[model samples]
Target: MNPALPLARLGRATLDALAAIGQVTLFALSALSHLVRPPFYLREFGQQVMQVGWFSLPVVGMTALFTGGALALQIYAGGARFNAEAVVPQIVAIGMARELGPVMAGLMVAARVASSIAAELGTMKVTEQIDALTTLSTHPVKYLAVPRLLAATLAMPVLVAVADAIGIMGGWLVGTTRLGFNSAAYLKNTTDFLQAWDIGSGLVKGAVFGFIVALMGCWFGMNSARGAQGVGRATKGAVVAASVLILAANYVLTELFFSA
Candidate 1:
């Protein structure tokens, strides 16, 4: 049990963590810089838009719908303790629009799209495809990372908007049928209490989360170790990192948007 050995291991871990962070930051900046330059790949971008955005609708919608319904039940139960059950509609709308909708949609996309991107790119890397692209004078970041990044960033807000609607609808269904509330009144309260900013803030969060998801996926994939195990690990790491970052970023964004 030598103190020097323990200290040495801790120092190495800290250095490794810092190094990883620096690498990811540089990678993100490089991708963003390339985004504004020439040779825009419309075909690749369109394919990514379909893959990262359109294909993600089902999972996002389902997640939001279930979350909204569960949230309504939970809020209703808690409000009942204080005879504040009528606050359900307002709470549900705000919660969904300002937080749950975007967060859930982001996490789902991370789970689905992030892993797919990581696996695709990781396989490409291990098979020397990325190197081949470089040999052909193709920039990997510009060709691979930029399109997915742009597609996710652009499409996430739309997905969150749709999720917000579906989520609110889920709350309405629960409030009306399960909670003994009137359908018209539930919808009215939801609309009346929700403001434009609530929706806007959530959409902004969607964009940020989308960027994080794609960036993490691409970063991990591009840096993945050789072999099947490495690709698997990269895919797993992308999902976990994206999900954690989404939650952390959500808290920060919430404070920025709503804190007094």
Candidate 2:
């Protein structure tokens, strides 16, 4: 390999990445600023709540249910090695509420809502609809991005709460039916072990993850290249970026909330 060529390529890649980061940061700040100074679009916000939140419930619920069930089985099997199988309820409750529930809901919403937003906006951009909005004196970021961002952030905590309940119920179903535990006992153990912080922390994580998801979608879509292929790429990139960011943010939030 030629040393000069490789060095040039590395430098180019670094610059491109930095440029992308700068662009995204500016876009995020713009959206945030639009969020407070309104011309508040309550109708758009309500539509997004339905699109992003209400439509997302089934997938989130199914994911939480299966994950909770599988987690129960895994934890039970693992705990049996140390004669601590009885810890299942408490562990499941904490595990789901503190981590899995928010994470799963966030990822699921990213997959669904992020892709939809990216595809829609990317299509609008390529079709010159965004320009039309601008020509009509509508700020694209305020008209398109801010409402979605606010809706997602507000709705995600509710989604996470539902996910938490469904997940714990899943573990309860497994514990009572498969693991030969009493229903009342399992419920009691779950409630007894859970504190306000565990659930609250997850909800907080949900809000952050939701913001990341919508932000990534809007940012990528706004910057998408022209044509169908560009729109497809933008949609895919939005989901991938949102998911990675969600997981990364989750770890950071977890450390802040739990690492005493």
Candidate 3:
């Protein structure tokens, strides 16, 4: 057993991870630099907005709604042991506004939008369309990546806001119907306990998550290998990377926003 082998493997993995991080950072910077350049693709931007935002609403809404309802039930059950069941509405609202709403929406968008972007761009790369665009004097990053990055970043906050509302409504519904709570009182408690900062923080998290999702997709897609298997791998990598980054970013943002 060569003791140096394990250390060597660890060092190699660390270097590989660092290199990947550097590459992604450079890719993101390149795409962002193209945002202010001329020949803006309004049509592409509009299509991406619709694709990433509007089409994502239903999934975001449903996820939030179910999560809120389940959260209320769990809180109520837990609070029962302490005779604090009356705190269900408040807790549900705070949880959804501060964490679940934005995180859930981000993961959902990462799964849907990130994979789609990666697959589409990977296909374009495989088919040489990206090269064709470059030959025609078009900057592929500007035409292909910038619109998606911009759209996702702008749309995520809106989706988080909508998710928060639906989630709170879900808690309200569950509280009033199943928990035998008064509707007016539940609504009042939810609104009274949820501060503007809570909602605002979640929206900000949403925006960051959205940017991360798009960035991962574009990076993987553009760097994908030259084959169908490579495109599939890129799509999978985009979703996985976006999801992990979303979770990691959520923790960082939560710490920054809520740490004393």
Task: Give one clash count per candidate, in the order shown.
Answer: 0, 0, 0
Per-residue lDDT of candidate 1, residues 1-260 (tens digit)? 88799899999999998999999999999999999998899999999999999999999999999999999999999999999999999999999999999999999999999999999999999999999999999999999999999999999999999999999989988999999999998988998999999999999999999999999999999999999999999999999999999999999999999999
lDDT of 2 by residue, 1-260 (tens): 88799899999999999998999999999999999996999999999999989999999999999989988998999999999999999999999999999999999999999999999999999999999999999999999999999999999999999999999999999999999999999999899889999999999999999999999999889888999999999999999999999999999999998998
Runs of candidate 2 exceeding 4 Å displacement = none
Instruction: Please list the Cα RMSD from the true structure of every candidate, rounded to 1 decimal place.
Output: 0.8, 0.8, 1.1
TM per candidate comes to 0.99, 0.98, 0.97
Runs in model 1 deviating more than 4 A are none
Scanning candidate 1 in windows of ten residues, the lowest lDDT window is: 183-192
The full ranking of all candidates by lDDT, starting with the best, is: 1, 3, 2
Clashing residue pairs in candidate 2 (N, C-alpha, C atoms within 3 angstroms): none
Clashes of 3: 0
lDDT, model 1, position 151: 95
